[model samples]
Target: MKNQTSITSVLLMSLSDDQETISVLFIFFLLIYLMTVFSNFLIILLVVTCAHLHTPMYFFLGNLAFLDMSCSSVTAPSMLSHLITQHWSMSLSECIIQMFFVIYFAGSEAFLLSSMSYDRYVAICRPLHYSQLMSWGTCAEMASLVWSTPFLLTITYTICLRRLTFCGPNLIQNFFCDLPHLFQISCTDPTINVFILIIVGGTVGIAAFVITFYPYVRIFRAVLRIGTSDGKSKAFSTCTSHLTVVTIFYVSATFIYLVPDTSNLLTLNCVFSVIYTLITPLLNPLIYSLRSKDLKAALSKALHIHRLHPDTATRR
Candidate 1:
């Protein structure tokens, strides 16, 4: 029989038991964490400095970049420290705090993603109404909704989930304290938690994403109906970056949550998480800059001026 007491008595699972693997994992994850942070920070800087990127699209792009940076930062750094010291110990409060940040940032990302989809939909579907609809005030409100509502949901679930008991061997198989990971490590029946996860993930993750895309789908249809080569190219050109982001985000997220929860499939889930954690943040900014004409122009001028500063300095 296990201890079934209050939330203070609950203990989390250790990350791993292998000493050699832990050290190796620490070095690898540290490098990844550094790159993820640096690249996203650079994107934020470029977005802020480049005048042409001051539009709604870039503004939201900056938001997504910041969220990605935050997401990786919250999860990666702690995991690295634990791995290096082979210390799988996380205090109860620390575990809850980690989970809070994880959920907050993850929920925030989910909301921001939906908002980005809405932004794309308006820009592509109703170009005439975009300025009116996606005005600065409107944009700020959209971002707020995207960040706040999900956080409330996550906090509610956390409060409920944290009340469960755990008084046995605690060793989490995964690299981090994920939602499903918590359920697996718990002593009590995680039926309610899993049910809530499915409900929230399906309702918020899938439904919200679908709702956001409804307008974009219409925009995509409208663009395809146009007969002109130039018109089709232009319409697609406007949406290609967003589409790429949508596919990467949706595909990876669905794979992680929708997969059957079993030991055999855990490896696949971890791999998918790595992509969401490591790659997409760095890739999104590159995709936007590569695909968007305004970004390309601004980035080019910014880089050119940057390159010239050294020569100008030498002359001075």
Candidate 2:
């Protein structure tokens, strides 16, 4: 086994080795990366500029959009570059940094989703207290906690990873440097890392999952209690988008992380990783914007304003 000094880089596996397949994948994923960035950015812009959207929910959404963009960025560029150039090797430090951000944003997004669910619960179940419960200050505090806590956890995980030596067979099975893939390549005993992953990571995931979905139980109950169909429809509409996103995120993520990464499952893991990392970000803005009348109106208004005054829009 080689020491840390000897292993300076690790090779990321490509989705395909065939030149034609690589080209097709490059084009497909490049488009996905671009759309994910642009759409998420649009959500942030709308939330920032549209006064109507300056509520606690949109505030959390803007943060989610930012996180989605960031999480997609953490891997998509590197994966896309590898697809195009077939140069799959990255410096070990770069890989670690990428892994850190990947875990950071992912964990952060999970908690943020829980926050969004809580926001929805307050709005629907306790409408009278929504203002008090989800004030700007409260939202800011939640956002701060969402970002900071995961950061510290990721730092601990990364520190543990750095202590491990990488000797031979440095090829990562996935398109990016993920925790499980990284553990598989370590020359040193990764028992501690695995322990932290299983205990801390599992606890965090379960906590976030409970926080995120438990509200929906009450929310559904409240929705069911509504007298009129229109009233029920309106309340359900508000939550459906968020619920869809949360479901997709957790389901895809669970498949990627929980499933055994055996030889037969490697390809399936790659597919799920694509769903979790690439497709989810791409779908978020579309899901929220399409389902939301307020967002649609705001987008339309923004577009009309842009068309009416392209110069002003460009200056801004």
Candidate 3:
């Protein structure tokens, strides 16, 4: 790549520089990426085709599946390609665009998780009013808010980052063009960028965390109030999958962002980045669909329908 800007391009660090390790890691990540796409797509297919899953819960879940695929796409494919060639290079513009989407989808996922939590809270805590509370319009509005706000905010920071000139070593010590990694290579002061990340991005993270978990606090209380063991069991079952997902996502996110890394090192950040960017997306659909009898039934039904008429999809 030719130098197009103050710095023409940046070199991204591979997960491993060793050829043998790169080969092994390439295969491992390829399998993981493929599995993540397939699993999330399965959830989407089941949600779209199954009439029984058209409720608010599954609607949010379908959106999540789409986001998971997108988030994984942002980094996994690029990382895989770089691993194979052992050459991780991207032009300045490409790096900025990649970072934008990474943050965009990540922030959107955070808000979407919170939205799903609210849906669960309504369904379990106020069962009588779930329909009234989570009507089609309400859900649509929430979805729109979660998706759009993140894009705008991410754009703001990306543009801020773009304005910063890069005149130093163009090597980024991470698999992808993460904001922090980008900050490390900038010639201009990144104090404002850091401020936005901490104040704006941190605020978003905290808000997402509070929204996502606060509902569970009430949910737990309501679950305990149930008199029958079966009722309590049923209530807990409804939210456990979501709770598991939330815990994984938030813990990874908090470790990455909220708690400052005193060392400002890239090694630890890379590990956590892989968790949320790749592992969380890979696990989200499983968490939602694994223990779900309805999802299983839907999947079975879809397969059965496909077996009955292989050409049905083509006709549609």
Q: How accurate locally, in lDDT, is each candidate?
A: 0.75, 0.91, 0.88
Q: Superposing all C-alpha atoms, what RMSD in Å does each candidate have to the true structure?
A: 3.3, 1.6, 3.0
Could you tell me how far off, in angstroms, the CA of residue 128 lies in candidate 3 after the best superposition? 0.6
Please report the candidate that would top lDDT against the real structure. 2
Best by TM-score: 2
Backbone clashes in candidate 1 total 0
Worst 10 residues of 1 by lDDT: 6-15
Off by over 4 Å in 2: 1-5, 314-316
Q: Write out the backbone clash pairs for model 2.
A: none
**Candidate 3, after superposition: displacement of residue 288 in Å?**
1.4
Q: How many backbone clashes does candidate 3 have?
A: 1
User: For each predicted model, how many residue pairs clash, with residues at least 3 apart or on different chains?
Assistant: 0, 0, 1
lDDT of 3: 0.88
Higher-ranked by TM-score: 2 or 3: 2
Write one digit per residue (lDDT tens) for candidate 3, span 74-187: 999998888877788989889888989988998898899999999999999998999999999999999999999998899889778766888658988777887887888887
**All candidates: TM-score:** 0.86, 0.96, 0.93
**Please, what are the lDDT tens digits per residue for candidate 1 over residues 104-181?**
787787677678778878877787999999999999998888788888888878888765666434555555666666
